[model samples]
Target: MKNLIKINSKINENGSIDFKELNIDDFKEFDYYRIVNPITKEIFYNDNGKLKLIHNCHCYDIWGNNKSCDYCVSTNALVTNSTKKKLEQIDGNLFLARVFPIIFDDKTYVLELFQDIGDSYVKTENENLQLSQIVTQLNLLASKDSFSGLFSHGFMYNKIMEITRDNIMPVALLCMDIDNMKYINDNFGHYEGDVLIKKISDELIKLNSDNVFAARTGGDEFQVIFINYTKEMALDYSKPILDNLEKILIKDNYYASTSWAIEDRIKNQNAKELIESADSKMYKVKDIHHKN
Candidate 1:
């Protein structure tokens, strides 16, 4: 179908749409459409509950409610000023819903799209299924540490960037380093050292939850990001991890004295700064531990 593509959206221009506002006709391509003011839950970007744009396609009934869905991620995207996507089920059909913020008439608006995706992965052949499994395995391997099954440094950094860019507020980072791993490896053997590393990875992995992403950022070093966290909570989390590692026997007269650094996100918009801040704190603690 040919589209009535606009030469320009004229979002911020002087000669914009009538009254510098928008209507349902602005987004005519979608199955169902609405230009929303997230703060007011109305159509169009306005201070009051005034709808500037509202239109529905024939399939609107399949979506259930006439108003916006409850617990919408659109609200989150609006708050964070970022784009968010989610897969939702409605009337036995699956849809990939996207929410993004846009500027219009010098105000903020929420643009939403719901794409149908109910039958995108139905393959009948066994070979095709095996090939799909291989692709999935490859993707997982790319993001994981082969030895410990924890997230690799590269993938962890990528996730940190994603988290920082997203609307996850009150985030905290914890960087940890194992004590004297080289000594353990040199005297006891690399095998025993590997066992200790695996033990640390296992304990760290056990702390995983909906709000945390844990990764092995370096040899004898691990990092975890806690969403909606505080300094006190991060310390509370550290105690359990140290207690768990205390149960493992590294060697006679030898014990693990791990050091950690925790930092909350405040005025930092990049992952490198956040990780470095935590890392610097960890080193200070490690240096003191070594001296004593």
Candidate 2:
């Protein structure tokens, strides 16, 4: 406190002196003074590093945390040029008093004022990343079958409607079911039956093409709907899936049978109704397999 009192007394004693007579030592202990480069917006301050100066006039809350005010236009101008001009003072919550060009040795430096701005910029960026992750999870849950990871029945219907609306032709729907799947679960372990379901779904998805949509619609039941396809095209598409199934079974030493039917002739039926028709036909094929 005694030292501060002495400093203040010295400043008062120098009152009314010509400004040019003052030197750097005159304000050596001044607590609040800043030097900043105008073009880079970089800031410097007195030896204590407590006060930063630039040309903006706003309250602490307005500019965000540690952000200087926006109205420091004159300070910015001085740092960009090489001449001295009369300083101007303007009104605001805070404003720059003057812009001084400091020439040290051969290089030039600038001095400006700064004020605090608030802290919302970083928070908004983090919120965007979290929102993106949520959208991705919701889509996965909506499109997937909970048990088999195949397409859900609702997704299949939506796809059929979407394709048909696009001016496609010769659409066919084929519903399929595993023959005696429940019987296998009753006799063998449910784990073994689950393996069979997974195997069938894998084979079906591998048959994906521009025209086909495959899904496991229910337990032990699956379906494929083909767009822009004829009866012959449907059969040709099914052949690869059937052959793949035979290879998988022979490799695993497990026997599972599936039945599917193409409902291309039923043009009058809507998507759901068409799937039902193919489902009924699939049951007939399953019954024949059972009898044999």
Candidate 3:
């Protein structure tokens, strides 16, 4: 089945399909086919032998998912320029998707061929749904903090490595720490300290979006990475958190306060250096709070 799809179909310099000896008729064996720009998530399909792009239509729309898949095979194929396959469930039916990296108009794209395999693979719709839920839970357990429900420290480290390796620019990192956490724990008890952490997590979660990745990196330390954002923009986005924390009263008139630092990715800075820079700047802010 893998041999049916060619690995690298190239577009000619003149802007015509080279096909690279690939027979387009072989695609007919699949139930449906679509060309996708992995970065933009745009969907394009053949219309009477001509390719046409669908406006505002994403591949995830077919799966009825609100966002992109956590492990996106199409994006993987585009990144590695390799053929990949994954089983996707849509509308209670199983689909086998074979992704092949191709060049269209000198830009990389993925050709996704989907064939329905529900009857052969899935026993019942309810069973499939249960399996999907279990997988989602396992993924959450592996990547998320148990108490705060934000991403774990390990996940944040891996994400930083990915961003650095990929050289994704215009990124900002926000390092945050709850001020006087030990003081709160000693005076109010550990339970109250836990409550304060959860309150801080709730505030951070409110800032989460498609471009924001928030993680609880330590006991009272949180980090947020903003993609495609400048340092100024990231600071502006986080100002509300400071204002909100000032109003949160945990108990006994003690307010939930935090010290944070925001730093933009600099040229040639690795993941470790970037994180260290942010952490150092955060401590400076904490020092100021202590002096007061």
Candidate 4:
């Protein structure tokens, strides 16, 4: 290790290496390691306690469940100690490095090192990066709506196709429009209107059931796709929002009316068609409210 460091010092003019971020070439050049502050969840240092150089990569692309992997000396050291006893004892895939605590002036620091035994460490690094990317993409697909935080028209259509493929279950679609939304935006502010949309969305979220999915279909218009819900359930769920309209207006010092259309699962109905039906109903209801 001493000889390796001595040789590296001559080649590495800058005199620093990021242990956690080491590739095969880097692993070969420098004895790499890491230091992790468990409490803070901060990977403070790499080999020789140096700040790592961040490449032009997004956080999701670079780090997965393994954070501060680039500067992991604690892992390297464990691999080192084990390899010294039996060359064959080193495992290629599974590597665990022991963490050593350095206490100085009431502060404790831990360091971990990596041991390279198998194929070129570059291959391993690339594989890890690929895995990180896949995990990120999967999470994004699962957690977020295709368009904005609201369900996209296309996404809703796809879901409807799947849910109504067979006589599998009953589904209901509730479409809504923010009444006088354009007027509010023009009079009060666009920013306030945006806030109102978010507030209404939040209120809808509070009213959601286990099987309920809410989405923003268009500007000032939203929908709730209810799977296996009865007409009574749909009406009951909507009452909260309708009842709370005055409270929301008073709290925010702005008046916003809402109109809605509801539908139940029927033969040959798709998400697009369902949305259109609800939208038409909503418009009719809106006209009635305006006239009154």
- Candidate with top lDDT is 3
RMSD of each: 12.1, 27.2, 12.7, 18.5
**Ranking of candidates on TM-score, top first:** 3, 1, 2, 4
The Cα local distance difference test for each model comes to 0.64, 0.54, 0.74, 0.53
Alpha carbon deviation, residue 27, candidate 1 (Å): 41
Cα misplacement distance, residue 27 of candidate 2 (Å): 66
lDDT of 4: 0.53
Tens-digit per-residue lDDT, 81-179, candidate 2: 432222221112122133356544354555332221212222454554554345345544645577777776655755664444444478877788887
Best by TM-score: 3
The all-Cα superposition gives candidate 2 an RMSD in Å to the true structure of: 27.2
Residue-level lDDT for 58 in candidate 4: 26
Model 3 stretches with alpha carbons more than 4 Å out: 1-137
Please provide TM-scores, in order, for all candidate models, with all chains considered together.
0.54, 0.50, 0.56, 0.50
Error of 2 at 235 (Å): 2.1
In model 1, the Cα lDDT at residue 207 comes to 70
> Model 3 clash pairs?
none
Residue-by-residue lDDT tens digits, candidate 4, 40-132: 334543343344423333221212323322222332222222211111112223222334554333555444444444344324667656644
lDDT of 1 by residue, 14-85 (tens): 523342445434433333334555544455322243433433322223345574332345555665566766
Q: Which structure is stronger by lDDT: 2 or 4?
A: 2
